[model samples]
Target: MTGEPFKLGDRERDEIKWSCGAGLGLLTRYAPGDFTVTLRLQPENEKRDRLDLGLLRKPQEDSDIGEGHETWVPLIKNVTSFEISYFDPNANTWLPRWPGAQLPRLVKVKVGRSDTAVPWEAIIPLRRTPY
Candidate 1:
């Protein structure tokens, strides 16, 4: 399922919670200007499978508003052992937020699958250190 504008409001959160069955839960929250997403998967036994979480962005050049050329900005991959996976735009070592570019506008979750790695484009600008 694909959703546009990528903002998870209260109603969307409620729907996600209701749609989740006995062994699943979806948690979302906003921190300042950024958002956080967490997926909880519970199984009866020890058996589990790997899951990949990706953040995609639409290119500015695309004509379609929400259905533009989507690119995978790899968040986490080959996550086999962890039962809980989360993505927080504010706190991540892999991709630091830049000054002008916008945050990811889309999220993609894949189970037992892998995609080609895409390197983050922007470089974190250096700030002056206070003495």
Candidate 2:
């Protein structure tokens, strides 16, 4: 709510509240140590884009995701559009900006690829919440 604005890569929004914390993955129960995964969209060309995943070993206390030794891995390529939405349980609605300390109940990712005519979408539910 404060600062310049919330920016996801080049796009910016002033309504979303950004927080700093660590989150567990699907292998958190089987594995150990803090695991954080950050997804970002990088432009491949003027009309296309690519999705990149950043892996962090330690927890970050600040808003910046570049605190520890992170690895950038390409997850998908030839992405024409990438959109993320957070489901707010209290509001019973999906929002573009996930604003709060607690994690969203469901995270939705929609991707449009150049190779395919139909867009791909996925709705992932988070098992853990800060509350």
Candidate 3:
């Protein structure tokens, strides 16, 4: 996908909040299989003092539910960058997986918050990798 900066409206931000709270992860069946995930964190935001971000995977569709499993990777605070990619077993390399004609899957974003009255957690359903 292209490296472009997009603005999030109130509704969009609200949706993200709901999804995070829902704990089901973000489901993305949108277009453009390949893309970049960029989050600009402003620590000065009144709602939150710190934010933790990480990736989680659901091993199986029917078996796992709600934040299936947390990867060994540690969550990051303040600001961070990540790329989602799929392992191409045949090619013996990792490739960028994009959303196409496939059932929507949940990509969980393990969010940790501190010093906030309201907890904003979210999961991202990704059809592609970060690349």
Candidate 4:
């Protein structure tokens, strides 16, 4: 992948604390607009990995519960499913996700890794609202 400059915020950077969470160790801050947030994922074993995303209109009350002025847009399965169903991480589990939809208001990405798991870095591009 292309090695572009990446930045992390205090909240985003704090995800490293959990061994089950993303371990890229790079935190970043992205505003609402056209953006591409990328993450690095190295799977440790063989399992189903799905990603989730949310874009908050405002800061979240609690980051763990996945709250905020958050607008949710799930990820696609294997880039091919992006035009189909969508992604969801309601229980923080890695399975039974990806309900792909055509043209979503994509804001963030949540990765659900199965098997041995890996360090998954999420990259999300902000979608322009076609009014």
Candidate 5:
């Protein structure tokens, strides 16, 4: 789960600092469903050194109407430096952020710890279809 030929930019370094500072991160997840889920790292205490990974769910109907509720469900704890990237098939490149109607060919997630050198990462493939 760890190891990589990875590079860090100003943006990435800032993100790492922000995540560690607030002990929070936002992770996007796409699926064939009526709702959307975003995974987030939230601080477990006021110290902001420890965090919990959680999912925030919101129904499409609510988002469209602008009058609905969201639910937060925690998954894991003591997480840090969570980052994500999307691979655009059209552009044939990886992007730091995804904001398109079509699904990206691949989704890459990276998680790091303050105590470790290389971060843990995963590249997940998605259907090449438009939503």
Candidate 6:
């Protein structure tokens, strides 16, 4: 399960790089639990990427204390990036994430260009009304 759409900015791009460099992707899942969101990010690029799968959800009566209404708990974010790269301010080198996300806001396919510094199928799981 993926998400709707969430744009990526310099801040987000940087976050996903240093934090989850390898599995640098954001995927959402509409599971049958509290948080139905999963942000994929791999701090390293490897063959068998790792998964740091997490869940995102609003606040519930049994929810944690400090957590806000909209929060994401990383679950599968340890996967290695087979193609994506960060925006290097040093050599001016740059790469883009693969189209494995569920971003419906992007221009479907990123035409031309050898790389993209942003997410493709960006996952933005729709928030459900807490029961």
Clashing pairs in 1: none
Better of 1 and 2 by TM-score: 2
Q: Model 1, 1-131: lDDT tens per residue?
A: 21122213211111011122122122223212222222322222356444344443333345666654543334455533221122234564332222223333222232332343432222322233233
- Model 1 global lDDT (CA atoms, 0 to 1): 0.29
The best candidate in terms of lDDT: 5
Give one digit per residue, the lDDT tens place, for model 2 in 1-131. 11122356554322222323333332244433443444555554456445332222333333455545443445666555666778787888878776456667787766666688876888987656455
* Alpha-carbon TM-score of each model against the true structure: 0.23, 0.55, 0.24, 0.18, 0.59, 0.21
Clashes of each: 0, 0, 16, 27, 0, 31
The Cα error of candidate 3 at residue 111, in Å, is: 12
lDDT of each: 0.29, 0.51, 0.32, 0.28, 0.55, 0.32
Residue lDDT tens for model 3, 1-131: 21122223321111021112122242344322222222323333468744234333223322344543422222366532223333343466633342333322433232224445444445444445444
For model 6, what is the error of residue 89's alpha carbon versus the real structure, in angstroms, after optimal superposition? 27
lDDT of 3 at 23: 26
Q: For residues 1-131, what per-residue lDDT tens digits would candidate 5 score against the true structure?
A: 11112233421221211111112232344433355555656667787767666665665556556537765667766666677777777888877766555566787877766667887789877665455
Rank ordering of all candidates by TM-score, starting from the highest: 5, 2, 3, 1, 6, 4
Tens-place lDDT digits, model 6, residues 1-131: 22223233321221121111112232333333333233333233345534333434442333456645655555434422222233323344433442334322221221111145543443222333133
Error of 5 at 61 (Å): 5.2
Q: Rank the candidate models, highest lDDT first.
A: 5, 2, 3, 6, 1, 4
**Clash pairs of candidate 5?**
none
Can you tell me which runs of candidate 5 are displaced by over 4 Å? 1-34, 59-69, 128-131
How close to the true structure is residue 131 of candidate 5, measured as C-alpha lDDT?
58
> After superposition on all CA atoms, what RMSD does each candidate show versus the true structure?
16.3, 6.9, 14.5, 16.9, 10.0, 14.0
* lDDT, model 1, position 86: 22
